[model samples]
Target: MNKVKILNLEIDNLSKVEFLDTLQSGVVFTPNVDHLMKLQKDPEFVQAYSVSNYKVCDSQILLLAARLLGTPIREKISGSDLLPAFYTHHQQNESIKIFLLGAREGVAAQAQQNINLKIGRNIVVGSYSPSFGFENNDLECQQIVEIINNSGATVLVIGVGAPKQEKWICKYKEQLQNIKIFMALGATIDFEAGNMKRAPKWISQIGFEWLFRLLCEPKRLWKRYLIEDIPFLLLILKQKLNLYLTKDYLKKNSKDKRHSWHTAGKY
Candidate 1:
């Protein structure tokens, strides 16, 4: 698959369905680290964002991070590479107003301040950190929608961490019409606020970014990487095998169907 452009974001070819599906069904899929590493090597995988709904799989998000880290714009880059890219893009082109949602109390404020300090002025249009576990409340969700809509932000960056962040974006993408791009960047706020440490360049380049993160926050992330990462990789492999088999079966079936049509016409 080739990369397609959607609203200032470059998405890899393998993710077209996932991106489109998010637009229609609001269900975003998360891609693994390996796919992200592969995307970085392929220039054709770059995408530009427009007015359409853009949903980036997890792998694509990591690839964006890698690009920013490899080309550091400022001496002080955020722990999560995603923030630097977002910040850098905004700094270069201040045409878009951005909204920050979903971080610990004051984390968004800290991030906003950091961006202002780093970029020499405030680029963030609005920043809000909902109460702990606010996703569970319908009112909170509505309030968030209202805040974003009223702020007139073109992009909304959510840092609620996965599954929640992904789910929230999918669920609310429609209602949040003012925002052109909605990115669910996990823990990017903390990283930007200097609350966390990003992996070293060598670790990121070697695709050991996850390992570095685990070492830094073992108590929180050790179980996730140690237990979930392997199973996740296995599942992705299974999906790839299934796709290959399906493609072969479809080709064979089409050939047989053509033959059957020819025979029937002859008879």
Candidate 2:
């Protein structure tokens, strides 16, 4: 697979591009916003997937990914970048076939309908609502995999929430090898499905989407947003500080052969 490059982001494989292009052709890419934010502070996390030829980016990356289809370049972007790309792709009639998975009962269907209303009909291929704890069931897992495989979907968007969605992709990657793009979209399916509401555009722009979500589901999300998020931020800060300190130390101690000349030859 060829690598696609856009700005600082690089897509290592063309399989996803080819698949989407052949199916929907010009659909915008949408990824998990939270994951994108995490990647900004943790390049290692981004690189881990990047090296695997996976483009784990947000909306912006999706936009760039759409543009680089069949082109020889890398695709890298964020959520903010996807809106415009979607519009452009829509105008070009190159939309990709999307499959929405996860979320509450009927949420996937609702999300698909909403996206179709927003992006147009046929943009979404299908939607499925799995068992609440589908991840733990091997039989259910195989069943879902079979459904996805038979769907001939170009992009399979999993919204079963984190770690689980990620784990599912890792476990089924081999079985779904024919799948070009497999995104673990976390709550996006729920948000789209209307099971949850997304923050207003202004709030999202200001990076307060988490706050809005917490406001909507205070009892369920307060701990995660207020407590877990804070510690996560702190950990990110610590990691950054350590990286800076390490770089500074390396620079300070780096060998300078010119300054270490030996003058003891005469002795």
Candidate 3:
């Protein structure tokens, strides 16, 4: 698997079909700009990402960033698209039973029903919607593990949110002995349950899906799109100019404000 380096991570440079064919059962996490920014400071999230078997490009912004850095990715495989593709690709394979975890109350169950109906079989064997902050509760998490294990699911699709979902899977994956594949796919369960709308293909193709989402839920996403993630473009520019600091150098000098990032060595 060829990879393209973007800042602190190497994204698998595989097309949708190629990725589907290559995956045999391992951790999958889609990296976008927000995730990239988080990786810069969140040590726990970084560790979770380090355990990922496949880190694929999940944003057109990242695709453009890769192209600007002279390593163009083959495709943008967002979780919204990948989930549908996975079930469709394995429609006839009985060994691919899936368990969905996340979304609001009752949403994961609805997604299970919808996906199984679409696949014409019970490809999705179980679904659970964890309460808010459930990741912090050891007892609830244990119950969730038992529920999934008892369901005989081979694939676990968790979609609560980014670092939480990724970190939780990394922490408890071993307890669920039956799971072969673990995917931390944000908000895909909501989309699958028809609780939210996705941007049209044309908008997504033109790299405006973020803008579409911003307009749809300004109150919930304004900071992520408008304020917090504004530095991604500058970081990409630093990479293009060969001024981005290597991971070790950044760690050693992280507390030394005098070491200018603009004068840093290559990543």
Candidate 4:
């Protein structure tokens, strides 16, 4: 399992085909520019990422950054793309039962319906759309867990958002003893449900999908894309010039060293 170092995270250096063919059972977290920026100051998010089995590149900008830094990633495996590929790849595998969690009301259900129709079978067995701040309510979290458990789903695809989605999975994965795979894919459920349209292939290829999203929901994503995440480019420049303090970043993450991403073994 070779890895490409991108700032604080080490992304798996696996192509889409390689990953889809080999991955069996483990947690997957796709890191984008916003996620990287959050990781800089969000200790809880860092802790959640520490326990993940896979951290793959989810942003085309990150992929380009990797190339600029002289260690190119094989591909960009965004959550929106990964989810569809995953379901289609395992369409015939009866054991690959999935549960859709997150998105707005009815979104996950709609995604389940669409995916089932595409696969010609019910690959997505269950769906749930948690309420606002549902993660903070212990009882609600437990009830949702039970619902997923009762649904008999082996794979859990959660898409509430970053940090929240990752942290929730990290906290409750143990309780989900029946689940074999956990995927924290932001907004993918919406894409599958057709509630949101993805950027055109050409736009995505040029690494401007963030602009497309910002254009779509300017009020919601402006700060994320234009304001808060601005430091990512400077950090990439620092890395390229060998000015990034890797030691300091590692020291910040040292608290979670006890958790090993490879403990469950690779596919």
Clashes of 4: 0
| Candidate 4 per-residue C-alpha lDDT over 43-114 given as tens digits, one digit per residue, 9 for 90 to 100 | 667889988998889999999999998999999999999999999899899999999999889999999999
The model with the greater TM-score, 2 or 4, is: 4
Model 1: residues with Cα > 4 Å off, grouped in runs: 1-30, 33-79, 92-94, 236-267
How many clashing pairs per prediction, in order? Answer: 7, 20, 0, 0
Q: Global lDDT of each model?
A: 0.55, 0.53, 0.87, 0.88
Candidate 2 vs 3: which has more TM-score = 3
Cand. 2 TM to true fold:
0.61
Descending-lDDT candidate ranking: 4, 3, 1, 2
Per-residue lDDT of model 3, residues 1-267, tens digit only:
799999889999999999999888999999999888767656567788888999988999899889889999999999999999999999999999999999999999999999999999999999999988787678999999999999999999999877788888889988989999999899899999999999999999888999998898888778888976898898889888988875753475354435322222110
What shift in Å separates residue 56 of candidate 3 from its native position after superposition? 1.1
Supply the global lDDT for candidate 1.
0.55
Task: Give the higher-lDDT candidate: 2 or 3.
Answer: 3
lDDT of 3: 0.87
Per-residue lDDT of 17-64 in model 2, one digit per residue for the tens?
453343332112333334433333333333334423345344332343
Q: Name the candidate that leads on lDDT.
A: 4
